[model samples]
Target: MSINYPKSIENLIKQFSSLPSVGRKTAERYVFHLLKQKPEQIKLFAKYLHDLPNNFKTCSKCLSLSEENPCSICSDKNRNDKIICIISNFQDLLAIESTKKYNGKYFILGGLINPIENIGPDKLNIKLLVKEINSKLKTLPEIEIILALSPTMEGETTSLYLQKILKNPKIKLSKLAQGLSTGMSLEYVDENTLANALKFRGIIK
Candidate 1:
């Protein structure tokens, strides 16, 4: 069914629809909303889009997206350096931060293990994480690693692999429990649920 939209409108719809989980109808709605915006607002939006890549840089330590190297969280001296939270992405880190229950460092895995996608243990930043942990051990006697990943099959797989590689008597590995529903990403969980999960995190053994 052709909507008979003009070339520019159709192109905008196509671009919006290309985004994750965005359907054609949603894309059309987005395009219409954009069309309703003032020219100044539209230009500002386009400027932000154009400047995004250059403005944001991935943190060297945790791999989280930030404007500065080491990122604010990593560089913050007040945060507990002995406890490191391993997360799947920057969004998950933000979700946890919103709770204010966890005052620790973070290590972003970048992505989860998916055999179909050919994303194995080597594909992630596991090596860098291990290096960071080992380097930190010299200053700190003991450290806690929190596996703050989603409860999906890929999350489990990645967690298990991390457990095997990071097993150490001096290090304690734990994961968020109870309040988190199964198969839900941390990024989308409610603040209350996330807070409870952090409060009652379970030891991985």
Candidate 2:
């Protein structure tokens, strides 16, 4: 346990350790691996990381990470605007998109409701979602809002909170079929399974 490494390398390890799921050993390995890389390559990587936070912004409509305001999906004319899929994060959005069975727009919640983490509905872009729904009702064929969130506790909490707020007679709200299970995340589900589940989404009670 000798602290003999250079200050810069130690600092890199600390930075990597701050990332999710990266332990001290993994961080050290990553720093050493980067040391083997060319100086220009490392500089480019560092520059990208440094610029990332300021360079990207969340999409106004879907809450997806993008440099543009609305993101490509929200602006795409070919996408079905009528059915908006509600997901916990961008990963779920990508999961559903991989199925190629859904053509609707999406609303990324950014994260789920976790009381322990103090992440509530207000912290999410729920107000913007409501505005989007209301505004689209007049101009689009928008009829349904599909709850494609995971079956985890936080996901269920988030979905119920949304349902309570968006309980309008004019708009139909539905949840994905029971095949997703109570604790499974959409990210791990197969494309065919996700497609089938979406095809048979049930009306939320």
Candidate 3:
């Protein structure tokens, strides 16, 4: 009735299983695969994983992960400061950026509003977003807010909450066009489809 694997190997498997979408079987496979690799390589990988959290910081403006305080996109002079694309996560932001059609800046919400999961506006960085908008209004004077969140229920709830908080006539608020079907995530949309959606965004009431 004794397990063949060492205690350390079992512990590593447990740790890997803790990751999102990784089950015990996959974790075991991963551990065995890593065991096959050279100690130096494993050491390097471990070092990188251990240092990642300390190495990267979130941008003050957009909350994107970055080595710098403000990410490259936030500091880019070529990007349009007049418009800000609001996305649920960094993956959504990357999806929009891949289209190469959107020239505006981005505000990453980190996640959507999932009431069932107890995630709400306060849990998100909404206050920082409002502060960013206020700062922009004072400096730029003319800016638009674009909601590029997913078409899911959570996404809609988050968008509505953000719209309510950022409701100012001075800021032109818009949402991505209906091209993106309901219940679909932006990350899965093709580049051309995403580009067209961006090109034809509509004002949100």
Backbone clashes, each candidate:
0, 0, 0
lDDT of candidate 2 at residue 178, scale 0 to 100: 81
lDDT of 1 by residue, 24-92 (tens): 999999999999999999999999999999999999999999999989999999999999999999899
Q: What are the Cα lDDT values of the candidates? A: 0.93, 0.89, 0.90
Question: RMSD to native for every prediction?
Answer: 2.1, 2.1, 1.7
Q: Which candidate has the top score in lDDT?
A: 1
Q: Model 2 over residues 1-205: C-alpha lDDT tens digits?
A: 7667798888889999999899999999999899899999999999999998999999988988888988989999998888999998888998999999999999987788999999988898788889989998888653799999898999889889989999887689999988777798889988988999999999985
Error of 1 at 152 (Å): 1.7
Candidate 1, residue 186: how far the Cα is off, in Å: 1.0
TM-scores, all candidates, are: 0.90, 0.89, 0.92
Please give, for residues 1-205, the per-residue lDDT of candidate 3 as tens digits: 9757788998999999999899999999999999999999999999999998899998989998889978999999999999999998888888998998989999998888999999978888888898899989998767899999888899889888888888787889998888788899889988998898889999985
Task: State residue 95's C-alpha deviation in candidate 2, in Å.
Answer: 1.2
**Poorest 10 consecutive residues of model 1 by lDDT?**
177-186
Q: For model 1, what is the C-alpha lDDT against the true structure? A: 0.93
